[model samples]
Target chain A: MKLTGAEILIRELIALGANKVFGYPGGSVLDIYDMLYKNATKITHYITAHEQGAVHAADGYARYSGKPGVVIATSGPGSTNLVTGIATAFLDSVPLITITGNVPTALIGKDSFQEVNIVGITMPIIKHSYSLRSACDIQRVVREAFYIATSDRPGPVLIDIPKDVQQELADYNQNFEYSMPAKTIKIDLHNAISLLLKSKRPYIYAGGGVLISGATATLLKFAEKISAPVSSSLMGVTAIPYDHDLALGMAGMHGRYAATKALYDCDLLIAIGVRFSDRATGNKDKFLRQCKVLQIDIDRAEINKNILVDEFLIGDVKEILDSILELLPENKNKSWLNHITKLKNSHENLLWTSNNSLTPKSIIESVRSVLGETPVSTDVGQHQMWTAQYYGFTKPRSFLTSGGLGTMGFGFGAAIGACVASNNQRVVLITSDGSFHMNLNELATAVTYNMPLTIILLDNNALGMVRQWQTMFYEKRYSQTALDRKTNYVLLAESFGAVGFKVMNVHELTVALTKTNKITDKPVLIHCLINQDENVFPMIPPNGTINDIIIR
Target chain B: MNSKKHPIFLLVHNHYGVLTRVAGLFANRGYNIENLSVGCTEKPSISRMTIVVDCSESLLDQLLQQLRKLIDVIAAERADPFNSVSRELMLVKITHSPESGGQLLEAINIFRGRVVDMAPESLIVEITGEEDKLNAFIRYVEKFGIIELSRTGLTILDRGQVSLITKSNNN
Candidate 1:
């Protein structure tokens, strides 16, 4: 049972049920590529156009499939290119195992041609990393990497192996049995349940953790059982269906007015799987000022890290919810529901816009109408917030956006990944001119794979978010926010062997969507010209309280 | 609130780049390590590091959590200043002359220091004690025109038999 390190790695990946890998080949990874070539039928390796694209594909695969995405890259720049995608996955808490091939072990510190300290470079961002010292450690390293990547608030983990180690022989017949120690769940549920039952206005604030832990069902059931309204952080948007009676869309800086108000006015806030990010809790002191907060998270570090809570339950969201459900009493707060309903109604027309030019809202709404329940990914900018405000996601993992890092150029690769992960489901990438321009090279990836993805490019010709801030705070002093570029997106897509459309009005947008729907073989890019002055609404100004939301 | 110095101890695998990972964690988090000393432990495979930081209690807690999360790190805990025995080693080179050599020797003897090396006009004195004691010794030796000084930062262990290493049947 002796095998080369490369073969052992492949076997371990197969053992872990990872059949799909995204990567590009390079000199340092030749031995691994050779092994993969020999065992090509076992694993499907998607050779992406760039290392960044490979990592994003893995990230997208992880997000949609609820499995650890595997990616590979060679040494030096090839490894460095995965930095952004790794950071994106790390910040978003996506499970990813990134394997990079390094220069031979002896040439490590000599600044060999393609050697880089990827471990050092990515140390802060990754959950953990290993630089292989010997070929014999490959199996254990791979197992540990996957275990760490997929468990306990999952994030990206990197394993760097030198070229010589990949070619070295190792015994691979050792028993691979390994299991994480069971975490002891400790919580005074009696007190927590009593507190919930006694509250006149109880609100459940769900975040990405609920989705990561797959606790949406429990969350929905708990909300329904207790008759408590549910508000979601941006990352937790799809935890409850948008049409759910108790669902208060997204709650944050650009959150629904009603949702933010509910958080502010609640008597009790049961926060689950959420770090009170600054964008979510504007002016932390004023956010949930009147509420007694009970925060539950798997990571103990997240508890009381931002806003202090009255009590905390530290464990997996699903487990903790199950425990709470067992001890819960039947209760209803009629007045609170009625008040929330009123707030929802009052802000029903808050999102209305009658502009003649194509808008982000109109574009997102059109996509939603045409592609129901389609997985939507977004590059960060005004378009990201607009999609969060508009897209109606009925399931978890259906919406992918870089919430924690707010990374631009993230959607194209992720959308390509989502499409691949979901068996070529009609995936949509809503991006702005600024964000889309960052990683436009990923267009080649979608076209190469013939991924069924639609690119909704909201071309504002400016960094709309920064421009909006400049207008509001910088005394109308416009700086370098404006791109004012003439590079045609339609031509760009067409050159990449994909159908492209340019729409300036809602009529053209709808017509373009209709045409794009017809061309399903390849990716479609729709360039919508939007107003540069338009801004995301209900924005809480920097360092401002949630109460200081600007409706305009 | 004024920052208080806290000594934190960590047991980590003796491997390349482990120190960088530990130091990088503090640097990335904006936590300043006031003093740090690292060396091999009783077990050659394990290295022990003592990092003294001045920060708020909450920030210290975060540092400990982050340190414990590192893959190479086996254990991380704060060394209770009141319940731990701490020491620092300092080597000071003082300018020696016919008139001041006697005074320097007398000062070194009073502070329980030993002259490890000597030249025509300088003596290298080595002192091991608590941080404050070393500082006091240096202060008394400075009048003789001290030329150079080197210090191995604080290393500490709990005063009791409580061990940081997990006990095994073999151990």
Candidate 2:
């Protein structure tokens, strides 16, 4: 059938099983918007106040569902605004597709109105990009973009369609040929098995790659077969259930005391689907030095990018775990497990603060009592680390946050995405006062959609994370960490047509949170007041390892 | 001693902005590209690039892995310097006195180079060989005023029946 490029683009997305997308409209995207309006019943398009929020919504959707999320925008500033969200997805390896409308083919390099080279602007961050010149290429390009965005080691891909191409007529068809790059994954478990046999104490360090490959079940089985305790990076916090006996929650800077100590004392480190980021490995030289490292990742580039490994396997993590599960005999390392259990018991205070005063732990504990396993997201700050430390997650993909890029304003937009993807369940956005002001304009998006979301504002009246850094590392300079604002959050939420709750203590917070459960028609902003002196502890100073850990 | 410069070959889809992706990968990763030469191969869809990057073995391993990750690239492998044949084309414009012209011509001939263009004051000598050979030819005639020099960096291929394009496994 013959159809315009804009129509074909919408049809192609629908055929690819995309029922929803997020974006903002402008001059160049008029034709695409017109087509979207006609096919509004087929595909739902949610327009956020800013393009950045839309892209982030797409990213959150992708992260929560493990599918490619589509975000569309127009030219120039509209496209440039999506850069941060695009880079965030790139850093976290989220599968996202960004479509932009450019000036017509005739005005490409002529500096026409609202013309910008979005493909060029997004080259470094995106996995790949395409600038479409012809209307006939719409179906193939859309399919190709989707394929590239969701392939191995997935990330974002950009497609820039000129205005003329969107209006041009093309013969569209459903059939298309698509093939991804041939992945050559060579796996050898011989040396890995030998190293495992010779080791007495082994630790399993899993990361987002395990969750990305949907190998969480295999990861648990593998850990059981080896009788090893598990530690997760910030990206992999929910990979293993927080309640599991062998699971010692997050391990790194703000990691639980037992997990970090195990990373140091283990004889063998079986790193699965992880990148040893600086935040994860404070000083690589001192952290992984004692262990014979066995690094397993799908991307070959990540194998020796940070640290040298004694043995490595480059393949799908699920397959690799299965192969390892088959090759090795089950060894119940009772002594090592007992040692770890003792360590976990002794250092349990590090994970919780004394609840004599109102604190993030008490507030989080109250929220968890009300909401369970609803897929929480967070903005970067002290509250994010606190939630990471306190939230008891039981499944993979249930906890979403900006682990790699650590963007401050990432929570609200991501919550909207998750809320949209998981329709009936209410999603939660945990943000600090400082991070909340970055993109609270997204409140309009949540209100307009009437999304069932709970925005838990941990109002400390200061940037607690950086303030703690200034106090510890920079001789208490304090600097610009103090932020005092006079705007009332309850009134602000009321003006946005959402429910607002002001809570000061644990009882008040629990009561306010219970009220939010009944008011599920719109978003609820729970402004929980707390002291600014609270800081994330058990921090390993930058470039400082086990010896330099500060527990206070 | 370990050599720093390594020539890596890539088979990429022939299209626009492909070079930018490859070049951006190097620049973003802090790897230096010493030289590069690329052109179409026997297949119209596939082009070949022989990029020389100066880095350690570990960085080279990372670079090769990153290059292979590019969607347009069909294959990425480092050229075997010991078994592969490489050549470069250099256009050197040199100016000399009439009496010194005879010496320059003798020097160019010894290096198996020929004059592609000539004027009253200068002549452009075209030379095609390995980088060392080109350097030697320039050294032999450096006393004469060298006006300009341009080179199409090394293009390399293995000394075997199978080529990268023919040997690439798409499956």
Candidate 3:
């Protein structure tokens, strides 16, 4: 069948199993919008208020459902706005596809209106990109983009289609016979097994790879088989069940005190699917210095890129773990396990703040108790750290937050994406006043979609994360960190045609959460005002190890 | 600042922006690319790039792995200095005259070079050999007053029947 490039894009998207697209349309993409109108039943085109929201929604969908999210935008500013969102997905290794329409091929270098070279602009961030000059190449580019975006060590890919290509006629083959490359990387686990068997204090430190590879179950099973206490990075917080006896929550700067301490104490650190980012490993020279590191990851570049490892098994982590489980015999280290259990127990009192005031701890506890296992997303700040420290998630892909990029305005848009991915199932967005202000414009999106999102805005009236750092590191001058954005969020939510409730205490929070759960037709905002003085504690300062932890 | 230079070869799809991806990867990581040469291979769909980057051995290995992950890149590998045959083409233009005659000619002959242009005032000699031999030829004729020089960076091929094409489909 002969079809235009615009129609071909829609057809190819449906063929690739990406039925949901989040984007904002404009001049260059009018032909695509026309085709979308023609094929609205097959693919749901979500119109976000901004391109950033669209890309983030796509990222959220990908993170939630483990499928590449597709987003579209027009040329120039429409595509430029996707930079932050694209970088966020790139840092987190989320599979995302961004399609932007460019000026016609004739006006490419003439500096025509909306003629930006997004392919060049996003070159450093995206996993791969394509600028389509011919309508015939669209099918191949789409397949390759999808394939590269979802393949080993997933990340975002971009395709810039010139307007003329979209309008050009091309022979569209429904079955173009695009075959994926065979996964032929052989795994060698002999050295890893030998190291694990002889080790006394073996600790399993896993990260986002476990979740991305769908190896969460396999990781837990392998951890249980070796009886190794499992501590995860912030990205891998939900990889291991929180209720599991050996799970030591999260391990990083703002990680659980015991988890961070256990890393240095262990003799053998079995890191799986972890890149050991600087945020996670404070001092690279001193991190895991006492222990022999064994890393298992799919990307070979990540092996010694961060910190050198004694032994590394490069391939799919789940495959490597399964092979290890087959031949490795179970071993128990009573002394090491006892020492860790004691550390965890002794550090519990110093973990975080507690009690009934409208605090992060109390608010999170009320929200979690009321809404268990519901997927939660968050923006970056003290509230983000608070949620990571307190909301012990049990389900994989349940705790979606930007770990690598630490994107401030990432929550509300992501929550909206999660809701769409979960088929209108209610999800929570925990954000702070400072972070929420960057993305409050997305509230109109949630309201327009009638998305079932229960937003728990922890308005601290300041950039509490930065304020805490300034208070401790600086002379407590409070510089620009003390922000008092007095926008009435309750009224703001109401203006967006959504329900909002203000809560100052734990009792009010519980009641508001219950009320939001009951109101399923529209999005609900629970504006929980937290104290500005509160900070995410148990923090290991930058370039500081477990020894330099701030407990007070 | 004595930085080690390593030659890396990448087999990539003959598509636009493929070169940019490789260069962008190096630039984005703050790694310096000393020289880069790219051309289409025997396979029209595939192009090859020879890149010399100032980096440590470990950094080259890490970069090779990253380059291989690119969607357009088919395979990437470090050209083993010991096992590979390497060549660099140097085109040097030197101030030449009948006054400063056969010493430059003698040197060019010693390096088995041919003169592409030999004016009364200058000489443009084209020589293709290992970098050391090319540098030696330049040093031998420095008294001739070299005017300009352009050199293609190192390109290598392993001394075996196996090639990156085999590494691509099999590895």
lDDT of 1 by residue, A345-449 (tens): 885427755475677778888988875668999999889989988888897888888999988888888888888888887899999899988888888888888
Model 3, span A1-552: residue lDDT tens? 999999999999998888888999999999999988998999898888889988999999999999999999999999999999999999999999999999999999999998889999998888888888999999998998888898889999999999999999999997797878687776777888889988888899989999998999898888877778899988999889877878888888888888888888888999988899998999888888888989999888898989999999988888888888899887866888788778878845256674638888888878888876599999998888888888878899998899999999998789988988999899999988888888788888888888888888887788888899898889798999878567898899999999999998888888888887788878898998777778788888999998898776
Docking class of 1: medium
Candidate 3 residue lDDT tens string, B1-171: 346988878889998878788888998887899888888899899988988899887787778878877778888877767888988899999998887787778888889998998776987999999888988887888887889899988788888886977755564
C-alpha RMSD between model 1 and the true structure: 2.5
lDDT of 2: 0.89
Looking at candidate 2 chain A, the ten consecutive residues that score lowest on lDDT are A347-356
Task: Mark the regions of model 1 whose C-alpha exceeds 4 Å error after superposition.
Answer: B165-171
List, for all models, the DockQ compared with the true complex: 0.55, 0.85, 0.81
Pick by TM-score: which candidate is best?
2
Steric overlap count per candidate: 0, 0, 1
By lDDT, the best candidate is: 2
Q: Fraction of reference contacts reproduced per prediction?
A: 0.47, 0.88, 0.94
What is the lDDT, from 0 to 100, of the residue A392 in candidate 1?
A: 80
